[model samples]
Target: MKMAKIGLLLDEQTANKKWAERENVFAFYMKEVLDHFGIPYQVISENTDPMEEMDLLIAGLLNESDQAVQQLISYIKNGGAVLHLSDSPKLARWAGCQVDCGGPGYGYPAKELGYQKPVRFLKTNHWYRAAPADWNAKEGFLTDGSPEGPVIGELWMTIMAGSGKMVHCQADLPYSIVGLQQGLEPIHRDGVPAPDGTAGIDDGLLKADDSFTMDWSCDRETTDTGMNYFSEAYADRWREVFYHKLAEMALEKGLTVPFIGRWPAGIDQIATISHDSDFNLEESAEVTLSLLKECGIHSTWCMIEPGYESGMYKKIKQEGHELAYHYNALEVENGVWSEMEFKRQLQDLKTKTGLKHFCTNKNHYTLFKGWGELFEWCEKEGIQLDQSRGPSKKGNIGFLFGTCLPYFPIAWHTEKNRKYDVIELGFLTQDLNHHALADTTVIEPFLEEVQRIGGVAHFLFHQLHLLEQPKVGEAFRKVVREARARKFEFWTSEQISRWERARRRIKIDRLAPSGEPELSGEAPTASPVIWVPVPKHANVLGEEAEIRFGHLCIKKIPVFKQAQTS
Candidate 1:
């Protein structure tokens, strides 16, 4: 069986424009999702690019012209698969129904999809109101539970054209994904905190969660009147479900889609333990460092103003841990939030600690203002990774930002929709067993999900809490041991940033006519692996190959090919 060649179809008119300026930026976001999954694909414009070469096609948004629609139909009829993301009534017609605007409401997965709760969409989702051309065409629907309740919405409609098929999802999936991941521009600065204290929205300051587009009351799933674990990473699950559908389609076509594993070789999952040295107490930090050493973990320590003495800094560095900066904007004695203030703190960290670079940073109070401003500052200051997007209150403790994966934010508000240089690695929660924080209860499920999805799970704790709170220290030790038992490798922010950057540099050059994948780029450190769903009897060219996580994991993609098993 030949490896599948996937192409992301784009509109000819918008192909040359900046993603933000393009009439339909969904395809670019589709590309972003693919890149995050480490899937191999190419961009093909509707006018000039030939579709005959691709086994699978993903349309960011459809080119709704008659000729384009007819051409896509013909391709599908001839056995090419398509997973269309846009809401096209014409395409809906082929899928056996007419589409209409359905949801400004939440979308709960059908029982068969195996999801626990409903996920919210930022925009109106596509729904089929008309009688279907084919009664069996609709495979997935968002149904309201009342016995007399109407079937509110539909997610996927599978239409088989002669020898092939097309799965049309009426929802603006890419838009939802991007919106949930990066969040909306923080224009609404009204300070009104949650009554239950799940979110401290009344503080009269901007923060990362403030930029969220979803309504906190409706979007977040809460327990005990919003005082515990808030919600699952709905956005992350959406991505996972979408990818599984794509993989299923490819397998049906006798093709396989290979992707980059989130962690390095043999590591089931990865985690980062980051501490904000809030009081800059040498004794507190020393106790925390000793605890980390006992656990055999190397963590990232974000230093505040008037950081530990020179001796403490040297001791930390000598112990193989990472030194990072914590920017305070609390408006206390020296608290400020501005580009100038940010730079001053960064420079101070460099001068005082004698640390040349601070690749990772998290704000003092998770302080943020406006969309993309912090990102722009990060870009200017050479910060490669950020950890400020996470749950600050005890009530909102899990996947509040919608992901555990690190991603580059799109300047969707900009004229060109440019991408930033930095990656945002949103933490799941902060400080276990502390005031306004969930204890180890938040850890097990969160880590389990990350392991299932194969991404990094970042845990944040203030150094003061570890020393002052014994239960918090016990919780930290338990988390480290549990994560290790689950085969999760503990990493520093610098290490994570380095690995992700290096991995992004790598690309699948092409899938050869002979069905082997050709890759190009500098190899990532610690013997990272790429996953391929090799057809039974297919041979892969890699130094070591084994089947794991439902795919074949290859440590090194050897330049030569091997004969198929007899």
Candidate 2:
């Protein structure tokens, strides 16, 4: 197999300056990932003359620049495969291809906290249908003029046709460019370079075409990864069973699935504390953590602001519990605030309790307005992750929309600018949707999908809701135990965040300039030596010892028959 060379053409200046920076970073990182698979590539600035010998030509971060646009068309016409990222449909149409704009994109409202509508996949026969198969179509504004008619378009068009096969996307190029570079073929044909000083399509030769024809495409198979409930009574039970299966699958795949100790690895048990007056913080924290410890599990606690007793925040943290903000703006209904005010309140709360991450309550349904803006603010403030992009009532009910695991956020275009600061870590599943968990039988199938797609299984349970039902707790524990038996890893939100950070660092390192010194390594240390005091009456032959450490005390006895001892 001959090694292929790929070239990238990017506009260094434009409305996409930030995106350009990200693209550069990603290109470096991707080079490393591809190197692992034995692929070679290079990135060239837009100013360089077009090289006709490259296997693929990718255009990054382009806008409506007349000169740059003409160069791209010429590159494609000359038999060079092109991949376009973060551009408009007009570019695709100009290149002789079709583009679907999902529609007027909606932002979440702060009052809504997060989005809570189900996203459904509109059946399509596009080249990248595999994404929709693995992805759940949640609440989003589809581009206009599609068969679906104003639905949220999950796929963005970045590359369009000029003469050869071109791939386009609205998301960052680096994020989706790997697929194109690995697949498409460069086809050169004869054509006039649309006013650009570049080779026309008719002048170039085909250089091993096959950019989109690879057998290992990510979207090869399509299954319903949607979350829906069969019946109301079986919702909790279904969640338990689904979680158990998720752990089993993770173990099978050799991936650590982290969850509360009671559930399997990768299956998380989340308890929401909606009101401060409902439970005593100090007591509840101690009791909950103690119970979890007894069961060898750690759980996530969602806290509602202004609803808990004074000093409850400190108490919860002191107890070694996970804390997440639970927005209560929906409770007020008619309360409206500016984006600045909303961000100020969120920041103030973070300052008071030292809590940085949060998940909204039922208000996720209204995230398209205030909540979306807050997400942008979170990016500005350096918040690590957001878990608010779940399904609501307006979209498909009980569906998952993001990558099964954690991913960077797509850019959001405001009236003037675009922001891509925050990343989204999708919840595997939620209880309020009442879709997947409505029946116990659905557990096996639901979990199968989660494992197949490499997603986390999250179950949201309110303490009050479960207080009357101890069986629910037992069922949850059963799932956890099952997962542990399968060798899945349990994790807390903090742990997940840490892991994500580490992963990103690794990615960055791969993209860093070559010849950098290797990162440091650490060796395992010896286990602690335990000293036990012998009882005064104990003999050398056989003895018993009573040991004391801090508040713990234990008596040890030697069980031996009286042998021939001197």
Candidate 3:
């Protein structure tokens, strides 16, 4: 596929680098913006020759050399699209564009542009009629304004220019600058009339107008608008700009193009669920099993053994759901339970409920204190998996330290000289814990990480929380539906165990390790438990009300006599 070339000119000196690194500013926007457009772009020092033949040049705030400035002029003259973010107007003026100051007073430069004044579109007979009306206008000082400030004409700094053309504000357009043409076809941002029949906007000298008002009825108020919220309109504008830049670059280079990703083929994703209470498990298990049956999705559910409701264990087993123990040993606050007691309780629960495999509780954020001890116990007890690694606050210590993907726990000889069969299956970020640090927007990047590493994404959530809020439930359902639609196979914990066992056997056959005796028969076996409950509620023909669970319906016999006879 033909890829469009994009170059970023930024001044990454020591001081700026230090500041950017601390805040993760550049890294966050740079990768996201590039990925959004599917455009392959490279960042270069501000001093690099801008006149070099390229599809688009994004000059940062510090490219000030006369030669470098002239190079940008040449780039524009050669028909290359240029984006100057924050302080780039100085270079813009050198490129023959006239900048007129709009709005009142000098404003502070924020990371993303924040406008204070209402920007009214003059609506000249220009090409960009499709642009959104009434932008929140702010001031950009005129390129050649006198020390005092009134200018004849105002430059309404709106993103969309003429003929569906849009210039991204703050210079750094956040979207994939490549693949944009392929994705958003027919929309281009290059070579529209510059509002003035000239090559670029004129950099006329002007003075600021403190009392300019297009509408006298509207009060002029100044308030700080926070971060840009996600909107379809914004996304569209970004997509358009990205594609236009890419198309312009593609035309410059002779290359064959192909669309990204195979259509109709599913993209792989991981499905997971968290278990908090036994009632939570029972409800989730029933719903999940039914949903999976209907949609053919495999999902994992984390279980809290002691915390689970009575009779829930057998139900989970019958439904073929994976069971991982949720450990809250660290969160007791009083530190009442000892390491030995925790292990004993887990083993006892396993024996009583017939659950062989399990994972720790999400409450272990306090510390990973007893993880090593737990692993030792698992090795002795023949428990197979432990999906409890990752950040947590309830647990004072982290557990299953080494492995990222599922793997056998490193053998640590205890004082008692015992081995364990526990393998640590890592989790994706904890929903509550991580969300407390970032926001929902981070979910996409997290998914990308999982895809990149070919890892299973383990998500933990409280059923109560999900069910309590309709919006949250809908969002949760949407994420799951989207993931499934993308071709991710969901496996219950039991299913994962089965797959892992089969995978291990295949590996064993391939390796045939010395001193390790080959298994003479199929893997270990356990009887499946099934529970059948008597029907308590039923409908009868011509009956106005439903029959109750304890009450038997009979039209011919008196209730007292029938009970006595029985």
Candidate 4:
């Protein structure tokens, strides 16, 4: 039996033009998620791509191209499984539905798919409303307020077409994922006040909070008045649903979907501890460094300009931790958000420490302006990762930027298919010690959810508060203990950057006759583990790996195999 693979049909001409105009590149974001999960797939074009060779097809159609529509309908009619990622009228008609785009707004999942957070559907021309009774939807989106309200549209529906299945999404899946993660184009600064003495807002700059594009007011009845999301990592759960559906569809077709697990050696999940050196205080930095060493974990210390004495830098390097850059773009500190200023601080950190390279950076006060500009600067500076997109206020702590995983952001206002080289690992929140709202309780749930979805759980701390604030020190210890209890490995930002980049080079060569996937590429320092979803009675010819999440019998395979080229 031939192993199944996912085929992503992308309308490049239309997607390219849309991306250039700062529109959601549906294909790009969909592919981004697939690549992030290490799902093996082939990019197909509508004109001459072979659809029969694919076990499942994900159609990312941006326009109502007649040729593409006809091709998809024919493929589905001829017993081909299709997962449509567009609201094209022709494709919707084939799925027995009508397109009633009742303008852009928030949408709630009518039925729970393990995630109940309202997904944002703010795309300009392609927003949707609930499908009518005639649509015969299996699962759909509801009005923002309640699931009993008017049906917005089908969230996930399947129709049997010519002995095959057509799974459809009413809203644009790629757009929703991209919008939730990257956030909307910042128009004005959000007026939310920062913590006392914090430089989050009122600084006359577009801080990270200003870029929040998710509707925090959607599902807030359960939480206290101060909190926004009922739960965190909304995008992470939604992505898991997508992955589950893919596995379900593949299983239905008597096939298995293969992907590389996020972490190497089958670690349950990953936890990263990073400290922002705001004041460049040596004593506080030493305190945190000692605590980390005591816990037997390596961390990333983001250094501000004139960061530490040369000896302090040498000490940090001598330890198993990472010395990174902390870009000071806060105006109150006389910082400027200019490219020249970014370069100056980075250069200063490098010069002072005699460090030839810095892999990660987090802006002072989580400051950010515009879309993709900070990412562009990081890429230009040869920095591999950034951590400036998390929440600064109390209400929005977990998954504020919609994900804890490291993702390469796409260029919104630039040329087509342009994605930055830098990886964004948005921290969950800063200093769990400061607020009653964000305390030690947030750590376990966040790590659980991240483990459930095979992503990272990044916790941020401040060097100044570690010892001066005893509660802060306690909170840090609690995080480490809980994560360690859950078998989560602690890694530095540089380690994550290197691992992600290395895993991206890995590709599924082919399925062996024994039902194991053959992988090709240079394995990371820790060998990569490939996950294969095994159906009942279907043998997975490999060692069964223990993972924290998923009901399916996921088998793990080695990553050092050579490609079996025909």
Q: Give the best candidate by lDDT.
A: 1
Looking at model 1, report the run of 10 residues with the lowest lDDT sum. Answer: 140-149
Off by over 4 Å in 4: 16-22, 94-96, 102-148, 191-203, 218-230, 435-437, 536-551, 562-566
Model 2: residues >4 Å from true position, as ranges?
1-56, 60-81, 84-287, 307-315, 331-371, 380-382, 392-398, 415-419, 431-443, 482-487, 507-566
Q: Which digits, one per residue and each the tens of the lDDT, describe model 3 over residues 1-566?
A: 22335676655552254354442122223333333222345676645443365556555334456765565556565555554443344554542343332322211122122223222211111111233334333423221122133322212233322222223232233211111111111112221212322111121211011101111122111113211111111222333333433343343343211111101113233455544443444555555455445555444555444445547666666666555555545433332235575566567667766766454333243123322555655555555665544433211111112112343432211221112355555453333322222224434434443443334545555554444443444445555665565555565545545544543331111102211112222332321111111122433345322111112221211011111222
Per-model TM against the reference? 0.86, 0.49, 0.37, 0.88
Residue 119, candidate 1: C-alpha displacement in angstroms: 4.5
Candidate 3: regions farther than 4 A off = 1-269, 278-301, 331-339, 351-363, 393-404, 411-420, 432-439, 507-566
Candidate 2 TM-score over all chains jointly: 0.49
* Model 4: colliding residue pairs: 129-152, 130-151, 130-152, 130-153, 140-155
lDDT of each residue in 172-261, candidate 2, tens digit only: 323322222221112222222212221121223211111122111111222254323211111121122222222222222232122211
Q: Model-by-model lDDT, in order?
A: 0.72, 0.36, 0.36, 0.72
Task: Report the poorest 10 consecutive residues by lDDT, candidate 3.
Answer: 205-214
